[model samples]
Target: MRSRGLFSRCALVLGLVFLYVPILSMVIFSFNNSRLVTVWDAAHSPTLKWYVALAANEQILRAAWLSIRIALVASTGAVILGTLAGVALARFGAFRGRLLLAGMTTAPIVMPEVITGLSLLLLFVAMEQLIGWPKGVGAVTITLAHITFCMAYVTVVVQSRLAGMDESLEEAAMDLGARPGRVFFRITLPLILPAIASGWLLAFTLSWDDLVITQFVAGPGSSTLPMVIFSKVRFGVTPDVNALATILVLIVATGIGVSTVWMRYQQRRRERDVLLAAAANL
Candidate 1:
């Protein structure tokens, strides 16, 4: 038992190390004074020159901004569409065309990125030829492509959340003279708010981090941050890239920390309210 426990602990530590060592190295080397990301110049070490350079790099800045805008738009669009699809699947049981809708929504999640990207490229080209719309691929096309794939994730998340949620609350609200839409907005929506938020974040991250699909859809001047980083690394990774990565890591860590703390506080408040209600009833 002792040996088994030790082995499990060792495996967990190894897994953590494997996952985080590269990130830690990147963070450390972001502060390195040398142009080479992996090399350390102890004489003039731990400089902020790369961070300054990253800030000044117009191309990187432009790509980052474009990626952020695309991610924001894609995630919002995905949430709206996905929520509708989720509601249909969860509430409107055994409806006509249900199987088709379910299959379409889930296809992207299971399909290879390469195939999806290629298909989308062909679709855009054909659409342009047929309707003379979206004349060429660029930010608009990229955003649309992102929305197409990201929504699958949102739909799955929302459907799962709704499947597990108790219908009693919604039914009770409806029984109290509330309309279907009103019951959803007042009762069902609030209960599934966390799932929706999770879906949004997941979609945003997928859209932001996407490379293969973005490459197929993106035109000149539509380079995202991942595309830019891939282009740079093919030649050689510079210190500025490391600096950019470190800054991104810091932002993600901060956001996660803040959200975790806020969630814990909310949980505690809810527990306290429940206790107070029970005591008052007694």
Candidate 2:
């Protein structure tokens, strides 16, 4: 048992190292004074020059800003559509064509990114040829493509949450002469708020990190952050790229930490509320 435990510990440590060592290296290199990201200059090491350079690089800044805008729009659209679909699937109770609806919502989740991107590319071309709208692929096309796949993730999250939720509260609201819409808005929506928020974050992250689909739909002037990074790294990764990565890693870490604390506080609050209600009843 002791040997097995030691082996398990070693494996866990190795896994963590495998996952985070590259990130650590990137962060460290981001501060290196040398132009070569991998080579550290001992004499004038650990400078913020790369970060300053990253800030001044107009092309990179533009690409990053564009990606952010696309992610925001796609995520918001996805959340709205996904929430409606989730509510329908969870509350409608085996209506006609329910299977079809569910399948369509989930198809993107399972479909290969290459195939999905290719299909969307074909779709945009056909639409443009037919209606002479959209003109050519650009940010608009990328945003639409992102929404298409990102909504699948949101739907899955929201549907799963709704599926596990107790329906007694909704029924109780209805019995109290509340209309379906009022019950949903006042009770169901509040109860499912966490799921909705989670879905939005997940969708945003998917849209932000996407590369393959964005590449397919993006035009000459529509390169996103990932596309820019890929293009630069194909030649050689610079310190400025490392700096950008380090900033992103820090943002992600901060978000995770804040969310963790928030979740713990919410859990404790719920438990305290439950205890208080029980005590009041007694």
Candidate 3:
């Protein structure tokens, strides 16, 4: 058991280092003054010229803004649609082909992202031909494609939360003559709120980070932040890109940190309430 614990700790540390090293390197190099990203003069000290230039880089900044806008909208749509699907799956049973539907829901998780991008592209082309909709691929098409995948992630998260919960509270509410809608809004929704919150965050992050699907669906002049980064990276690297990456990493880290602290606080509050009820019974 001690050996197992030691191995686990070692693996965890290594895993963290592996994931963070590239980001750390990116942050460090973002300040390099050389036009060539290959030269990093540690002894001469780093410079911030790239970042200063980034402030005036209108094209890349516009792409970043567009990406952020699309991510927020798509993630919101995914959360609503996915939450409804999750609730139906969790709260309802005895429907024919339920297992098959659940399988279909999860199949996209393992599907290659490239295939997803290609499939979505084809679907959009077909939709355009059929209804003359999505007139040209830009913000609308990219966001819809993002929503398609983000919903899958949200459903998986919410389903897990629902599976872990006790169904008795909802049963009691229904028994007390509450309407099904009321029972869900009052009891079920609140109980699974944390999971829903987590799902929203997950969906947003996935949408923000996606490249393949966005690349396929994006129209001319509709480059996303990732597309901008890819273009810059091909020229080697720049400290401006590094600075932007670091800022993004910090934003995501801060959001995640705040969420974790909130979850812990809520968990402790629930535990305290449980303890108080137990004591009162005694």
Q: Order the candidates by TM-score, highest first — what do you get?
A: 1, 2, 3
TM-score of each: 0.95, 0.92, 0.89
In model 3, the Cα lDDT at residue 157 comes to: 88
Task: Rank candidates by lDDT, best first.
Answer: 1, 2, 3
Taking every candidate in turn, the Cα RMSD to the unseen true structure, in Å, is 1.5, 2.2, 2.8
Across 40-96, the per-residue lDDT of candidate 1 in tens digits comes to: 899998899999999999999999999999999999999999989998899888999
Scored by lDDT, model 3 comes in at 0.87
**How would you encode candidate 3's per-residue C-alpha lDDT over 29-75 as one tens digit per residue?**
77776666658777655877777788889988898898889989999
What C-alpha lDDT do the candidate models reach, one value each?
A: 0.94, 0.94, 0.87
Off by over 4 Å in 1: 278-282
After TM-score superposition, the amount by which residue 217's alpha carbon in candidate 1 deviates from its true location, in angstroms, is 0.8
Worst 10 residues of 3 by lDDT: 36-45
Report the number of the highest-TM-score candidate.
Answer: 1
lDDT of 1 at 90: 94
